[model samples]
Target: MPTTDTTTTDALAQVVAQRFTDTPLRVGTRTSPMALWQAGHVADLLAKRVPGLRTELVGIETTADNWPGDLAELGGKGLFTKEIDRGLMAGQVDVAVHCMKDVPGDVPLPPGTAFGAYLTRDDVHDVALFPAASPIRRLEDLPQGAKVATSSVRRRAQLHQYRPDLRIERIRGNVNSRLRKLDEGTDGFEAMILARAGLGRIGEAGQRPYQLLPMEHQGKKVAVLPAVGSGVIGLQARTADAPVMALLDELSDPDTAACVTAERVMLHMLLGHCNSPIAGHCVRTPDGREFHLRGMVFNRDGSRFVHAAAWHKDPATAGSLVAADLLRQGARDLINATKN
Candidate 1:
């Protein structure tokens, strides 16, 4: 066997770490509070990993951030990531941080761009927030025909399925704006559903009094499921940017990467679109030997749906198995119906 090179490898790593400290890495991201917090969090991680390394956040206003109308009508989730991706591709920024859920699964990443890392996952549950004066403390506390607001079709569908009499209204904006709207009684929204991770990132999860909507359906304990990649932050960089990619490799959590990869694969295989009411979640077993994936699909009104789950040693295989199972249960018909 060839002799090991402990000393040489250590020296090389020291050199690589020193090189990054010499030049600040430019990280592209949206201007929203949650987005800025996410970018700052990534920078903080890199700084901790490579002492003295500097990172600059380049905030860009995405179309989705500014658009007042429906995201589905504005061309879906890609709007949230498109400009930042373009900045990265044009060499204007060395890295781009994205909420993995916003990255479209129906299409491939832009040419020359690739995800460099997925940070450790965060809380995946959705929470219900009511106005300060409202008495509603949980989803079940809402009165019949109560109005609720959310931006995602997936949430809307699930809410309808959970409470058929509830009136689902569309609300869009950053976390702070949405909270303001809810507090001001804008559009008469009695409650709103938001990702718990997002609220945590923006420092509101702990400050606000909110109820965790049950992930599983009431009584039956069947999962309502979260959006694919809901709580993950993905770092994107040009494929040719070797040094950045190398540094990002240090930040990647293997377990999170594996689980999120499985969810994304399932979404891609299902051809889920912006309007598609689809949800998938993957988690590793406590023993860390296997992965489990659960997926759900619903029609526009949530009247019909299908769900499947599977476990495997390989993450991709687990996702494939779940996708296959959902398809067999008529997931395709539900997905296609949403597109029309």
Candidate 2:
């Protein structure tokens, strides 16, 4: 076979001369500290992906900050993203960078709005964090009837399944706030759980000895999932904006995007929301040519559960196939019973 670098080099030069010209873009993000960091990171990436692409971060507040009222009492889906979508609707921002885990499965976007691409993924496992002085070494180490703080139903269900005697309190606020509460041992929370990726992104990982996710108990390895799209940032844009979408297309990571696509398929097929006690985790084969999805559905109280796994050449169908297996194993009854 004959090989030449000239053709590839020439093609790159043409792309740079043509589509990579100077352009401006806007990114919408929430006002939380982590959200600011995310938006800033996207800004830096856009600058590198598109030549002379100027970006402005537009701060928008969403339901993530809505305290004193549970998201279940308010609206569950789209709380963190609806405001950003509004910005897109009014032409204020070109696209919104969102925490994919918070995005709902059923909400319809504006006529022109569409999910763009996902950035590179991070550690998808959740973590257990406790104060440095705390004696809690493992989840099983928590004293009987001790308080566990978290607002996520998925976490609550798994925790309940593991330790039914421990109290699962509905703790809300930003990552820092919850950590502070847990550190102070106020609200009776001896420990709290957070995503390892979230802590790492905010420069907080390894600050203390934190417990990593995919935990085990009673000599049995239990699969605990970070929320869907836990480590991936989703880009939402008006498909009508060609230049903005083109720039974002370059930012999309194929492997991360494909895995999250599989994860979302399970969430959507289950009709799950933050309030639903459902969880999933997906891993690629060593050769990177296949994906296996581990799916679990638990009753609200963790009283009943079903788990199943399957392999698929297509990441998108991996979730669907496993979800079907789970349904057959009685996931549908558990979900319906919880709904009622």
Candidate 3:
């Protein structure tokens, strides 16, 4: 990693000017603490890699920031991404860091914008946070009609398939709030499903008294298949934004990029969104060129499911191709059951 020389005003000025050249670069992110941390992490990595480069972090608020309403009714995943997109298009920010899962299946990036450069992913499994009875360890142990809270339609739809007898309930707010709901028993939620990575990030994973039942997606266990871009962080820049794009390239992880590319492509092809129980996972083979993907869709009630797997040449568009194949094989009907 490169370090900047900040010894003197003139030296710093010269260093900054030389590093940035004539064009300044800015990165935009959501206003949430996690978003800011993500932005700062990117900024530090970029600055360290490109000595003297002056990068500004801009915090922009989006619908998810202002409204506490249901995420499902938002219709698109853009609620979390559009603000940054606008910042890029308006020249307010040159690049943006995004949690890829929040990006919709079909994003109309402005003509000049492009996505590349991803950080390594984190744990993608969903953990169950329960309060009493340590012996009630896994999903099977939860009594019938046990109330499980989650906001994701995806989780709700899938959980129903496994334990239809278990009561599913809605939960809003961030990880901490949901955990508090369970611990305090004020929210009537016995347990809440949350991504283990999110909990670990906040340093609350160990404090929870409940056991984590690893989540599975598309027939692949969470430990085996990470949600598309689950631990990866993405940087997007305008195609014309050479300086920022080059900086991002310096921070890009080859393996992470390859996997997310395949995953996002699969998602884009399937038109899967936050509301869909559709899930996908992609992994790179040891040789680093080949990729494998698993995709699945569950009936609205989670009583039925379709699974597909595919292998692809270095790129791994096979995931999307597999999803398309599944859709051709009654996935549409199973998914449509949600509307009924």
Candidate 4:
């Protein structure tokens, strides 16, 4: 028998190991412009962190595709995630990227799949956009009975709290469509609410002198709290998937994960589902040594609700404490009643 070349075999082994280390990963995400942008952003980050890394975005149209009705009418759970989850379990995709806010709390993931990691968070505040020609810069500036477009229970409830007189109209479509509608006076809307992070990611706002623009498109923050998990990108992978899970861990942001954890905990504790009008936000100190969490729940009409706040060195459990406080304040009653 011919003797094997030990040096050659060793060199080949090293090459194989390096290839495994720099393996290309396929990412699953919605086909929408913002979702594609997010997946591409993740791929860029992975390329920087893992030498020779590559990725392709696998567009998955979720159950919510072309959904024109309000979430309340549709039960509001898994509309954006059911199909993506199936892709991972079927080995069609290595991982799935989700809008943290769009992920539902009441539904647990299928067995053997889990939350892998979260990316760096963006702004967690809601933004108000209005026709620049109009004087409505904020919710308070709306004229009595002025129409505003939104499908979020959280926004509707908060708006009711601030301006009960304003009419909350249901609106749907992509970011560009919504802005165009607002400019075209669709549903006679004077203003609309959108997430600041979404607008910033797409650079949707224009730079013209205020009056000439169809919509002001300013990323002006509002007083209302954000939906739990907003501005955070939720990564999902099969629990049994060591290779993909490892890659996800490499790209994860621990600080943002901690904050979102606290907020999600509150969401879980409240049993929040779609159209529940629940909101939570958490923040870590600059040193990253401590976490502060705030949670709120309101009836759909904003007739009643409860708010709670807490802090801890460990961000994960801080949300639980805040939720407990809110429960003691009768948050469950408000949420349950709203659901009914």
Best by TM-score: 1
CA lDDT of every candidate: 0.86, 0.77, 0.71, 0.77
lDDT of 4 by residue, 1-340 (tens): 1233667434543443354565556788888888888888877765655545567789998768668887666668578888888888897887888999999988888889988789888877677788756765656556789888888988888778767888898888777688878887756888888887887677774531121111112344225778888889988988887656655665678888888889988888888878688888888877867998888889988878888888799876898999899989998888788775
The TM-score of predicted model 2 comes to 0.90
Compose the digit string of candidate 2's lDDT tens values, residues 210-325.
87767334354334766777788988888887666655666788778888888888878887755677777777889887997887888887878888787889987998897788
Q: How close to the true structure is residue 72 of candidate 4, measured as C-alpha lDDT? A: 61
* TM-score of every candidate: 0.94, 0.90, 0.84, 0.86
Could you tell me which residue pairs clash in candidate 2?
none
- Which residue pairs in candidate 3 have backbone atoms (N, alpha carbon, C) closer than 3 angstroms, thus clashing? 112-239, 121-231, 122-231, 161-302
Model 4, position 278, has a per-residue lDDT of 89
Question: Each candidate: how many clashes?
Answer: 0, 0, 4, 0
User: Candidate 4: lDDT of 15?
Assistant: 46
lDDT value for model 4? 0.77
Instruction: Name model 4 segments beyond 4 Å from true.
Output: 1-24, 132-135, 205-222
Worst 10 residues of 2 by lDDT: 1-10
Judge candidate 2 against the unseen true structure and give its global Cα lDDT, from 0 to 1.
0.77
**Which scores better on lDDT, 1 or 2?**
1
